[model samples]
Target: MQKTLSTLTNNWAPSSLSQKVFLAQQVREHEAAAAQPCGFSMYMLMQRAGRGVFGHLKATYPYAHNILVLVGVGNNAGDGYVVATLAKSFGWQVTVAALNPHKVLSGDADTAQQAWIAEGGTIRPWQDIDFKNFDVIVDGILGTGLKGQVRKDASELICALNKTDLPVLSIDVPSGLDSDTGVPLGICVHADCTVTLVAKKQGMHTGQGKTYTGKLIYDDLDIALTFNKIAQPSAYLVSYDQLPKLEKRQANAHKGNFGRLLTLGANAGMPGSLRLTSEAALRTGAALVRAYCHTDSRLSISIGRPELMLTSDGLSAQLAWSTCLAIGPGLGTDKWATKLFNETMAHIESEQKTCVIDADGLNLLAESQHAFSTIFSPKHCVITPHPGEAARLLGCDVPDIEQDRLKAAQSLAKHYNAVCVLKGAGSIISNGEQSWICTDGNPGMATAGMGDTLTGIIAALLAQGMSATDAALYGVCLHGAAADIIAQQYGQRGMLASDLFEPLRVLVNPT
Candidate 1:
């Protein structure tokens, strides 16, 4: 059951997430400052921002006969005023549909509003109009300043807009997407394309942000600002440039120089599972990869990849010689599997060894807190669990894991006193302190044996001297990075775990 949850990763992926990070507001601020005028007046910047948005609209909806701008009572609404005025000048029927008619708008927004009205553009209350009648809807209903869930008038309008099927051009993120977590704060606007201004917002890429952003466009309003004053982002969406490069091995090195890897899993029909794990380990550059799984499983295991060694069970003393042990690829929940699981746990408890536990191994551990409560140091342990397995380990639900992935991973690391890899579409690795999100991987790699591949990658990293936490982060980052290459070669829908081996092999050769 724990292993089945690993496959759920297939549906949880977001497309090209790193590009979403470029939508951050911080970058938007930098762009504005580039075209700063002498005095740097706020109104002047707003004017440029309005013009920039109008420019994009012209290019996006050039054939539109009518353009309807939804306005609020803030700076976001002011941008709408600018868009309406620009479109009106081109003979496009423009309307400023004010969501909050009674609220007085001020600052640059107020000025922009009066100018649009003076120029013969009609400003009408939103209550008087239906969204379905609009040719194009410019959503200026919310801004980055919004916090908490949206409700009431704004929520109703967002709902109405979604039903219109109009090509919406959003300004600075889809209204309800969180600037940090990428989760929606209640109801959110669905945009056909979002033209974010000034700085990029974090929410546009991670979590559920991609769906809301649509065809995202960037607009830097040319304002003067200092990045030093703005705090650095707490997290990052991994990109190709951010991935660690793999180096070619030195000519003098041999198979022994890489590091020996030992694994235990595979029972009967599940040999494909352990076989996949071993192959990933070997392909990932493990010096000498070996496995202890069901003997009958060897029919397919040694067919092509003769490098793998098979056995029914492992010698108790063999733990001393192995650099890292990967456990639970397909260790089915049978009586013998339990005995093997206990024996593996015994080795981990008595010796200072590096090991990764997945699948049934995790289930067995969840059966009794006493098994996890053993007095072994947490430094050598890495626990990789999908949502359900994680839920069982933490005594919670799947929603709890998705609600705050950082919190769940960190909490698990702190409780278990080991690195926890919360396996999912934005796989998180944490040691109760420094945590990282792996931006690599695509929907194609979501097929069977994917998590096993990850287990092998991390174990290989550990065998080569990466600490439990570093190995976990590096492994996660590298695994996803490799999957990204596969995704690019084969379309996202058809990418496979085996396709990642070549990229993984290249990434870890040296550097």
Candidate 2:
């Protein structure tokens, strides 16, 4: 089964996720700062946090009679203790597994442990219990403080937990997860759901974070508003709701009222990629859509999709006539591709026309980095690159790119002087100074031709008179939203790029 968190209800999503995402350290520092102003002690905050977890557990897993709580040395264990204590009072079977020796617990965690004991709750060593006895596992072993590889014993326990099919609810951040990077240190708990406190950690929404953190539920512990005031967010998560709708057209509007766009690709043998892109532009309501392809591929492209105005002659002329240019779909990195890439760059530089770059087009640009420095401008260009392409553009490995996707995207924007779209789980749209994270897309979108389709959407939006920033922002959201609609209908297993075309039409013309 695909590892995805099903959006069960509107309640599954946090009502206030639009606020900036804080890093693991930021949440810790800010929570303390925010709590001190109200004279709230760590112990008091722990009580509120534990109560929050207990409330959510009762609401979500009402039928669960046996709960296995994993306790650590940190205050995260305190939250687990509170949950166990409450569960015992509710007359449910509760077992506390102490992954860390209970004697090491101090401060608020010690107080929490004493409270659990006061309620007749006994702690068991990690190895002493059989996991099958429990219906649910409460992971509170590690929080955001984890770094490096997980210890051997904890790693074994995590692996053992993964072997079982029981639903695991993680407290704070999952144990063995790098709350800053969303990457597992060496081993990480694969949670069925994660209850984050204070604010959502920025890492939990990107990279491997999504796979590890299932249905993400946030509890501010009632300190979010005050905490957010003192701790500036690392980045803001953006949604389509925050975007402005496209202005309606007049009754007398014609093709010219929208925008004309020229798509350059379909070099030799590759007609499908350019066709998907050109048709996507048409679907997005671009008035006049044209495709410039190799002489060999031109006939198939024309016969396959007559809606596009196909041309082999006047490459520079087409670039000048069109209001926006989308290049790189099926664009191979050969001498012929180089000629076209250079010519398109020259035209955009001279005319200052808006442009979108994707696929092998990014590869060609990566090859001539120094030459592009003089020509590329952020005001008119947007480059979409998946992780592999982004690595090439940034001259780093894919892991380096994934290690910090937000930074990679922002770096690409700054380095290329263009709006950069580092496409992945939470596609980051950046123009260096400002950034927005799109959280709409699903894992099924990991298909071929997806990037090509995105290029067409962004270019079409730009042609329709949106600013480069707005075009990039709206285009990414629209593309993802359309994909989501298709995933829902077709079950995402055999989803094709064309599945998004009809949905794109309906979404872009939002009434």
Candidate 3:
């Protein structure tokens, strides 16, 4: 269950029927494996699925006076018939683009089709109708059963669909898009909103799926089925606007009220890394921040920023005071870095200090595999690893992790019993038992030291008493929001991580 967040639906997004069927199979598999049976019947499940999808559409396009639903020969067409009939019964102008050329539909699909016709529904094909005349198109053609490239007729239909600027509400995933992959089957509908039933499909998160499935949304469809073997989710998306607000501060609050942030790294020429983290923490409202850097960088760091109590290769002065530690930004992974990382990890673990590890620190962990467990316990740690670092942690290649970020993030979190933020576009955040995908941040954040900024931001929020879950949500959002502001000032290409500090300050406490 989500942590104190509102339901997944904020602005509703509907999905395709293929996705619904996939969820059914998933539920069935869960029942077969988990020993708990879903109390609902299959037909009842289908009914809920149809109604839930319809409900979202009605809510989304409430202003549309006329709704045109395109129905095919499959069960998806049956769903369309259901919606169209409902709309017509409610006295709206409804038309059906019946692509079922032959008079041959079966099962529940045929039953629904006949009922629509009996109630005076009109039908036509692409050749016979001007699709643009409709305000909205309900695509129920060719559901998830479609595996190969779309046929000529379907492609023509899809092309016709593309020609119209009219918004489309797809039932059970978009037509011509693979429910599991989102790649167009040589043709696909560009839906404005997709209504998905039961559970979401894997294809919605990665690759081209995000484009086809505009605004990924979910609906349980009132199918109260017990599931045992929940397929590992493929990816995650951070829900928006449901983030927790900071606790109210008392007028008597002092420096001690905010947590202390400890940052390690900044080897010589790379003072930029340590500075970014320290600056970010302070700017993001950390009460106190201290940076431990190379002797060569100490003078420069101190000169550039008087706020930081910079020390050369000495963390003992700050370690005892820090509530959360951020390590590895600009920390080279050479002999010097290895020694520093090992020493810090050991001290943090032995002293029971809460910590975050990132950049070369993760690389160091990979280098000294056994040292990780020795230095940090599961609960007091968070690791921000990009694909390469994640691969190193798992002893695999980056491609394997990218193939499934959700699994990769989970594995890293579970193995260490630590919060793992898999850095990159659509970042995966997990604490082994639970996980999330960041829905914010743009390409401007691809610049250097961004990860370091995130490390400090997370540390700062944690020090501020946000639980790991809320801390992550707040940190990621704040980090992205800061980056966005910088991007606005310097353009995405010129926005550096350091540029984020001031923006972070504004976002943390605008008042």
Best by TM-score: 2
lDDT of 3: 0.72
lDDT per residue as tens, model 2, 1-511: 2111111111112235345687888877778878877777878888888888888887778889899999888888888998899888988899999886646677888899999999988888988989988889999888888767998878988998888889999998888888777888999999988998988787788878889999888898877667867876667776665565666666677787667899999889998899888988888878799999988898888886667899888887888788889999988988889999999988888888889999989999888845665577777889999999999998989999988888888899998899898899889888887777788888888898888888888888777776677788878988888888988988777778888999898887759
| Whole-model Cα lDDT of every candidate shown, in order | 0.73, 0.83, 0.72
- The residue-by-residue lDDT of candidate 1 on 53-149, one tens digit each, is 8888888988786877998888888888888888888788887888887788888899989889899877788878877777889998887767688
TM-score of each: 0.81, 0.94, 0.71
**All candidates in order of lDDT, best leading:** 2, 1, 3
| 1 or 2, greater by TM-score | 2
Worst 10 residues of 3 by lDDT: 1-10
Highest lDDT, which number?
2
Q: Candidate 3, after superposition: displacement of residue 246 in Å?
A: 2.7
Where does candidate 1 stray beyond 4 Å? 1-66, 85-93, 106-108, 127-136, 196-203, 215-225, 370-380, 506-511
**Candidate 2 residue spans exceeding 4 A from truth:** 1-18, 36-39, 369-371
Clash counts for all predictions: 15, 0, 16
- State in Å the error of residue 87, model 1: 4.7
Select the stronger candidate by TM-score from 1 and 3: 1
